[model samples]
Target: MRILFSGTPAYGHLLPLLPLERAARKAGHTTAFLTHASLGDLVAPAPVLPAGASLEETLDEFHRTTGTNAAEDMSPATAGEFFGGIRVDLGADAALAAAHDFGPDLVVAETADFLGPLAAAHLGVPWASHGVGIALEAPLAEAMWATAAARATARGLALARPFASVDPWPDCLQRDDWKPSRDRITVRPEAHESESGSGSGAGWEAPAFPGREHLPRVLVTLGTIVDDPEALTEIVTSLAGREVNVVVALPPSSADGALPVAGAGVHVTGFVPMRLLLQGMDAVVCSGGAGTVLSVLGAGLPLVIWPLGLDKPLNAERTAALGAAEVVGGAGEAGEAVVRVLEEPSYRAAARKAAADIGAMPRAEDVLPLLTARLG
Candidate 1:
C-alpha cells in the first residue's frame, strides 16, 4: 500500500506523525510527506514532495486575509478561517499532484492539515486524522470544521471525514467534551526521542559547564517562530537572580538581537537536543508547544507554561488541568511559577503518573493492522 501524509509546515504539526510514518514503512508500505518547502528537515528519511505556499508566505497571507496580527490574541473563529484559507489556496494543488503521482491507497494526516481530507475526498481514498496533543473540544472542533466545509464547497469538492483518528495524546489529558466517531486508535507519544540526534546534535554531548550540575537547573525555551524579546530577557534575568542555573534556547534569528546576558549562571544558545537536555533539567519553562509539553511530561519533569499563540493556550490548559504543569501569563510570573512547581511535591507526582500513562499507550508500529485494513 502507498500512504501519503500532509500537514501544516511546522514541527508541532509534523512531529506527532513521525512514529506512525515509520510504522507504515516498517510494514513495507510506500510513504511520502507533502508539506511546504520550509519543513524539509523535520520530514527526513521519508521522501518529501514540496507542496503549496511557503511558511512565510502562508503566514503573510493569513495575516492579510484575516486582518489579524499573529502576535496578538484572536478568537478561535479567526484561526479557523485563516487555516481554512490555507487548505483551499496554499495546499490543495500540491497535495492533489502528490496524490496523483503517488497513487496511495490511504492518506493519513495531522489533524491540522485541512488539505489532506479534501485531497482524499477528491481521489476517493481512505484517510485518518492523527491527534497531535489534547483532542480539541467540541466547540473549537465544530467551529473549525464549519470553516473547512465552506472552503471545500468553494472548490467544488465535498470534504471526506477521516475513516479513523490516531490519537497520541493520553486519555486523561483530553478535553471533557471530546467525542470521536467510534474509530479512534491511540498511540503513545514518542516525545523528542524520535527527532533527537538527527543532525541537530550530530552526536554532540552536553558540555560540562562548571556549577551547572551542582545548582538547581531549569531549561527554558520558546519555540522557533514565537518569542517575545522583552519577555525572554525578563525571564532569564529573573531566573539568574534567583541563583538557579538557566539554559535558554533562542531562535537563530533573535539570538544576538536582544537577550542581555545576566551572568555566567545563564547560558544562551541555539536548539539543544531535548533527549540530552532533559537529563540535567529539574524543571522546564516553555511556550507549551505540543511536542515540548509531551516530551517534558514523558520524561516525568514538571513544567511552567507561558503560551505565546496558536494552540498553545489550549495545550497549556490541558496540561495544567492534569496537574503536571502551571500555566503562567508572562515572563514576570514565570519565575514564581517555576518555584512553585519545584516546591510542590504533588506536581512532580502528577507528572510521573502522566508519564506512566503515556508509556502504556500502544506503540505506533503496533497499529499497522488498523491503519492498513481498509486496503484489504
Candidate 2:
C-alpha cells in the first residue's frame, strides 16, 4: 500500500503521525509524508512531498486576513478559521497537486489538518484522522468542519467522512462526553524519533551536574512555539533555589545568553527530542503542549503545567483532573507545584497509571491491518 501521511507543519501537528507512518513502512508498505517543506526533516527517511506554506507563513496570513491572533484568541471560531479556513485556503491547491502526484491508496492525517482530507476526497481515496492528544472539543470540531466544508465547496467538491479515527490517547485522558464520529482505532503513542536519529538528539550527552546527582531531577521546557526567555529565566531561577536539579531545554532560536545566570545545579541546552530529554527526569515543568503533555505522562513523569495559550489550557485541565499534573498560573506558582508533585506520591502514581494505560493500547504496527481493511 502507498500511504500518504499529512499534517500541519508544526511539531505538535506533525510528530503525532510519525508512529503510524513508521509502522506502515516496517510492514513493507510504501509511505510518503505531505506537509510544509520546512518540516521534512522531522519525518526523515519517509519521502516528504511538499505541500502548503510554512507554519509561520500560514500564521502570518491568518493574522493579516482575520486581524486576530490565533494564540491569544483560541475560541472555536478563531481556531477554526486559522486551521481550517486560512490554512486550507493557502495550501489546498498545493496539497491536492501533491496528492495527485503521490496517488496514495490511503491518507492518514493528523487531527486539525484539513488539507489531507480535502485531497483524499478529491482523489476518491480513504483517509483517517489521527488524534494528536485528546480529541478536540465538540464546538471547535464543528467549527473546523464548517470552515473546511466551505473550502471544499469552493473547489466544487464536498468533504467525505473519514473511514476511521486513529486515537492514541488512552481512555484515562479522554473526555467522557466527547466521542469520535467514526470507527475508533486505538494506537499507542510513542515519543517521536526520526529514523536517522539525526534531529532527535540521539547521542547528545547530558552534563553531569556533580553534587546534584542525589537530588531529584526535573525538566523545564516550554516547547518550540512558546519561547519566552523572561518566563523561562524566572521558572529556572525559582527551581534553582529548591532541592531539585533542573535541566532546561530551550528552543534553538534562543541564544545561549538569553537566560540569566543560574546555579551549578541548573543545566541549559537547545531543543532535544522528548524521548532523549526525558531521561532521568523525575518531573516536568512545561507550557502544556499536547505533545509535551503526552510525552511526559508516557514516561510516567508528573507535570507542573503553565499553559500560555491555544489547546494548552484544556490539556492542562484534563491532565490535572486525572491527578497526574498540577496546573500553575505563573512562574511563582511553578516552583511550588513542582515541589508538591515531587513530594507527593499520588501524582507519580497517577502518571504511572496513565503510562500503563498508554502501554496497553495497540501498537502502530498492530493497527496497520485495520487501516488496510478499510480500503475494502
Task: Work out the TM-score per prediction.
Answer: 0.91, 0.96
Give the distance in Å from residue 334's predicted Cα in candidate 1 to where it truly belongs. Answer: 1.9
Per-candidate total of colliding backbone pairs: 0, 0
For model 2, state the Cα shift of residue 25 in Å: 0.9
Candidate 1 has which clashing residue pairs, if any? none
Where in model 2 is the C-alpha error above 4 Å?
180-182, 255-258
Candidate 1 residues 80-194, lDDT tens each?
A: 7656665458778877887788888888878767877777887888889888877765666766777888888887888877778999888877777766558889888875444
Error of 2 at 267 (Å): 0.8
RMSD of each: 2.5, 1.5
Alpha-carbon runs more than 4 Å astray in model 1: 70-76, 193-199, 252-258, 374-376
lDDT of 1 at 331: 84
lDDT of 2: 0.87
- How does candidate 1 score on lDDT? 0.78
